[model samples]
Target: MINLQGVSLHRGERDLLDSADCRIFPGHKVGIIGANGCGKSTLFKLLLGQLETDAGRVDLPSTWRISHMAQEVEASEQSALDYVLDGDSELRLLQKQLAEAEASSNTDGHKLAELHERMASIDGYSGPARAAQLLDGLGFSHAEQQRPVRSFSGGWRIRLNLGRALMCPADLMLLDEPTNHLDLDATLWLEQWLQRFPGTLLIISHDRDFLDAVVDGIVSFEQQKLVLYSGNYSAFERARAERLAQQQIQFEKQQAERAHMEDFVRRFRAKASKAKQAQSRLKALDRMALIAPAHVDSPFHFTLPSSDKTSNPLIDLREADIGYTDRVVVKDVQLGIQPGRRIGLLGPNGAGKSSLIKTLAGTLAPLSGERQCGEHLAIGYFAQHQLEALDSNGSPLLHLQRLSPDASEQSLRDFLGGYGFIGDRVFEIVGGFSGGEKARLALALLAWQKPNLLLLDEPTNHLDLEMRHALTLALAEFPGAVILVSHDRHLLANTADEFILVADGRAEPYSGDLDDYKQWLLGFNRDKKRKEEKSSTVSGSEEKAPEDKKTQRRAAAALREQLKPLTNKLKNIERQMAAAEKALAAVQEKLADEALYSGGQQEEIARLNRQQSEQQELMEELEMDWLEISETLEDIRSE
Candidate 1:
């Protein structure tokens, strides 16, 4: 178990934590959540003993092994698999000793045998294979795993870092935004992997769905204190909402009482008969503690401005091959984007989701296709690269001013404020901004142009929960067409009306939601693995004849027959889950209305709350069924 007692941490003048206390038990999975710069990472560092607390104590077992994902990796020629394997220091040490003993001029047989036994005890011989699996689950291909670590891009390197962290054996694991660099498929894979981990896990993440799926508890940074909740992110949200609602009620009542006292003092201060009463009222008012109003509002609040110009189909592509000059990534794609369309591109990494989006945004031209655009079509394309394109020397005000030269400075400042750039922040140079700030600035610029169509590629990469929620709300209200490629499931679920699967060198409609897409990915990956295994086996033994076609067909038919009932049940569960989610989303949409919280809507709010709980429970039950059937299906497929 891990415990922090009266822990107070200070960064510069900011008191990140003051007398914060929390305890995490063995084999517990907890999520650390808060706004950006809320000391989530700082707390992890404290656990790792990299930083000493300014006050109080942090306690843990002295012998417990801890593993944490590194934020950055130095460029090196180490193979990705080797880098991951290096995470197991003990295994590497044992292997080194064994090699040295064997290579000695006068070999010590007993020492060599002892080293080998120790290695075997740790299953070090299979380290390479295990590392490869981690890499594979993180979106690295077989050939790519053998490539030098220095050869991969920044994001891939981060995945390699995550793989390394998973490779390590530990009693406690600390993962900070483990899914930030992963695609949806990889995120799903990691979710399943983390679910099976037996050790105590503390993850700091903004992805609510991932947190809900993996973590059983939540440790939130509220004010300057660490408050631990008993359930997942959804539970935490509901709990916080209720707490804030109560706080609001108390504040209103206190204000009314204070106002009554002040009025009494004002009306009777000069009357001789009531002079003593007035003085007492004034004293009572002074002694009364102020109840601060609950601030449940998000710092971010903005809408994606849409153009007034009309366009039926914002963009159209026919027989499009989207990729680079030498190779086509997604071939023969037929896609048409109409006004008010909300489409999410889903697939494995390097499966041409970004390529397709780029082509649609007209940033990447199709090799062979007819790309049509509406005459008044204004495309607002946002990508990670755009964040880099921002002028480092320019301020948020300057950036917006360049976009709208004739617009008033006050108007631009107000616009920037919606993106959390207020007052002096709008004039601050962009060079010193953090990644999340840069991403927000880029988005603010995108929203300012009033585009008829928005193409966003991983726009929420560095955003926090508040910013993500704000963006989701903005996208939900935007009237123009949107083509989004995001790993954030909450954003996709709430904003996207349809999904397009880009995989196997083709782009097509995926007739299911994210949950169904996850199921498809599992089967897709299993089949791919089987194909690879078959290809390897056939190549290794050319002399052996292949299996008879009739026998192969019979075996395949038998497997399908065995899987039929389970597959059908899984599909039924998925459909029900989707329906439950839709209902929950509807209730949530109603709950999001500010008017519901204003006043005099207690009955309506209660009804919505009950409905939300029911839908959530139903969704949870269906998910459990889906998981059980999925596991059974996987077992059959493996056999």
Candidate 2:
């Protein structure tokens, strides 16, 4: 069990939690939820012992092993499988000691035997198979597992980190936004895995369906308190709404009673006969505080306005080939997106969901075939990349103003407020905003256009639960057609009317729901693996390679020897790059200090500036060297 007693936590001046108390029982799956920057991640840090509580105690079993997903990935050339295996630190340490024990002739035979016993006890021999299973489940193929971790994109690296976390043996696990980087399929797989985990699980996620499926209870951040609610996210929402409603009723009653008492006092306090009574009443009033109604305020609430125009078919694709100029991903796609149609795209990552959406949105023209659209087809396309395209220096109001120049400032502010940029926030520059803020602004920009057709790809990537709930409601009420490509199963299940599967170089309608699709995906992967294994078996049976094996070994040795220097250089540069980045980040943190801008800090400011400049230069130089070495290593491996 984990218990927090009267916990008070503060981030600078803002008190995240004040005298909050909560207890999580053993093997309980608790979903942590709140608005972004409401200290959900900070709670996880406190549990991980990375942050100390300001005032109160957190009690957990001292011997319980805790595991957590890493937020950052170091640039390393370690294979994905090896990196995941490293999560079992004890196993790795045992293996290392065992290797040394075997290498030393003077080592005690009993010590060597004891190491082997420990390895067997820990299932160390099956470590590789376990890691491979985790990798495959997390959407990595056999080839990709053998590939170095540095080769993956940021999202893929996040998946790798999740896989590593899952690979660790733990009594308690802390996962913060595990589904953020995942596609719908992988997210489903992870949900199933967590459901079967025999440990206490605490997850902070915005995906409601994920929490609904995986958690038995919820821990919500509200009114500077960690309130534990029984049941899943949906249950918590309904219960909270009901509770708040009841609270409002009681508060109103209390306010009326207090008003009556105050009015009586004001009218009679001037009389000498009632003066003593009025003084006593005033003392009683001083001891009482006005009951505040349960405040449930969500910073996000915006709807995608429907275009005034109408068309039966918003978009049509005939024999289309979707992809870039150099490659075609999905071919022979015949589809029509009609008005009021809500179609969700489902496929493996790297498959052609985004490509197909791009083609439909006209962001990428088809390499072959034709795309026909209605005369009034106006698309409000939202993609992950579109967030970056936002003008960082511009405020939310400015972005909206660029959309509708003739609109009044008050009208724009009203519109932006629904998307969570209320009051002075609407005028603040977006450069300092968080990713979730940018995503909301991007969506806000998309909403203001009043497009008839919405093509959204991973639209909820950075949105918090409240924002996601707001988006879900908005999308549900949207009058126009929507083609969504998202990893958020809850969003898809709630908004989409049907599923379109894009795979195997083609796009077609899938005659199944999300659950059915998940099952199909598992079967599809199994069939593919089986076929590959059969083909390998057949090819092996036909090979007469007794002598060729010796030649292959010799060539492998020669390649390894040739790549040794480049590998060493790559590791060295990676270390230097990491160091430079750490130093740069430290300087940047200091630069963020408000004191640096105050009077008499010119010398300190100049020193930090010089340090920042030097670190940046060093990082750039190391990065170039790292890239050159990586490319040379790739060339050697290709040879």
Candidate 3:
């Protein structure tokens, strides 16, 4: 277990946490969540012993090993595989000792044997294979493993860093925004890996679905306090809402009681007969416990302006060929952005999601097609590079002023306040502001233009829960068409009306939800692996004698026969699980009914509860059986 007591941390003059306490037991996966500037990284640093708590004690077992993904890696000539293998410090130390023992003229035979035994015990010989698996899971190609670390781009290097961290064996692991540079496919793979991690894990991420899928609990930073909530991100939201609601109710009740006592004291203070009672009431009022008002204060509150008049189709792409010089990514594309249409773009990394956005934004020209814009069309485009385009010397007030030169200073300040730039902060130079602040400013400028069509790529990258919620609400209320490319599934689910998958140098509509997309990803990866295996076999067969055709056929037949029972069993389990889930859903629906908790319904409620519990248990058992059967089937297929 890890414990922190009375922890107070500060970055410069701003307090991130004050007298905060948190306890995490072994084997618990906790997601740390907060705004961009909120000390999430600082907390990780404190845990890693790189930074000391300002005023508190952080205690953990001295012998326990901790591992964390590095945020930056130095450019090196070392191969990616070797870099990952270096993460296993013990393995490296043993190898070094063995080398030294071999070099010495009087080296003991026993010492050499001992070092080799230790290496084998740690499975050091298999380190390269494990590193390769990690790299593949993170979207690295097989050929890329042998390339020098300095040869990859910045984002690819980040993936290598993650691979290195995952290669390390540790009692605790810390990951901060590991999916920031990952596509949906890699993100899903990482989630699965984290699910199977048998150690304490703390991850900081803005991606809600990733958090919900990977973490068993959430650690939230709010108002300079660290709060621990059970279950996933969705559960944390529900628990927080209930807690705030209860606080509000208590506050209202306290207010009513105080008002009543004050009124009695005011009305009868001058009457002789009621003077004693009035004085007593006044004393009671003075000594009464005061309840603070419930404040779910979200610092962010902004709305998109209504779009200007536009044609039926705000923009159209006809036979579009989009890409850079001498490179075509999406060819023969046809798309129409109609009024009030919300579309999301989904694809693997390097599949040209950003290229499509740039082409639509007119920053890139189509190579061989017509791109049409409505006469009244006005576009608002935002991408990662937009953050860099901001004037560093300017303030929030200055940026807003540039958009509305004729507007009053007070009006501009009022508008900026909605994006959390209140009072004097509006005048402060944005060059010194945090990433979240910079993103908010960029959004404020974008919303001020009132464009009829909006294009956003990864807009939620630096945003927190509150800002994200605010942005979701604003996008929902916006009366315009939107084209979004984001890894934030919650945003995609709530904001996008449909999805378009970009893959294989083409873009087309996908008739499925996010869940369906996940299934498709799994199948795609499996197919890729099979193809690679077949190719490898063909290349290796050149050096060996050809196998007998009859033997090959027999082996295939035997494998099929062996897989039949397992496949049938998997199907039966799926059917049973579906039925159990349906039954459970019906009982939960009944439980949600307010009438179920009324008087004279105790027996009915109890019976429903028993049914629900039984169905849930049945579903869990079926799921386990199904997983086992599926894994067995996969193993046979691989063979």
Stretches of candidate 2 off by over 4 Å are: 249-297, 325-327, 536-639
The global C-alpha lDDT for each of the candidates, from Candidate 1 onward, is: 0.82, 0.80, 0.79
| Residue-wise C-alpha lDDT for candidate 2, range 438-478, written one tens digit per residue | 99999989889899999999999989977886787578558
Model 2 error, position 99 (Å)? 2.1
Per-model TM values vs. the true structure: 0.82, 0.76, 0.83
Across 1-639, the per-residue lDDT of candidate 1 in tens digits comes to 899999999999999999999999999899998888889999999999999999989999999989999999999999999999999999999988878888897877887888888999999999998998998888888889899999998889999989989999989999999888888889988987887788999999989889977887899998899999766676566555545656766546545644644454454344323333223333322222111112236678787889999677888999998899899999999988888887889887789998888898888999998899988899999975788899999999999999889999999999999999988999999999988899999999989989999999999988888788778657855889989998888778766767888889989987776767877887788667667766766455356567899999998999999899989998899889888989988987786564666666667766775676567657766876786788788778876
- When sorted by TM-score, best at the front, the candidate numbers are 3, 1, 2
Task: Tell me model 3's lDDT, rounded to 2 decimals.
Answer: 0.79
Query: Which 10-residue span in candidate 2 carries the lowest summed lDDT?
Result: 286-295
Error of 2 at 515 (Å): 2.9
| Model 1 whole-model lDDT (C-alpha atoms) | 0.82
On TM-score, who's better, 1 or 3? 3
Which of the two, 1 or 3, has more lDDT? 1
The C-alpha local distance difference test score for the whole of candidate 2 amounts to 0.80
Clashing residue pairs, backbone N/CA/C < 3 A, model 3: none
C-alpha RMSD (angstroms) for model 3: 12.4
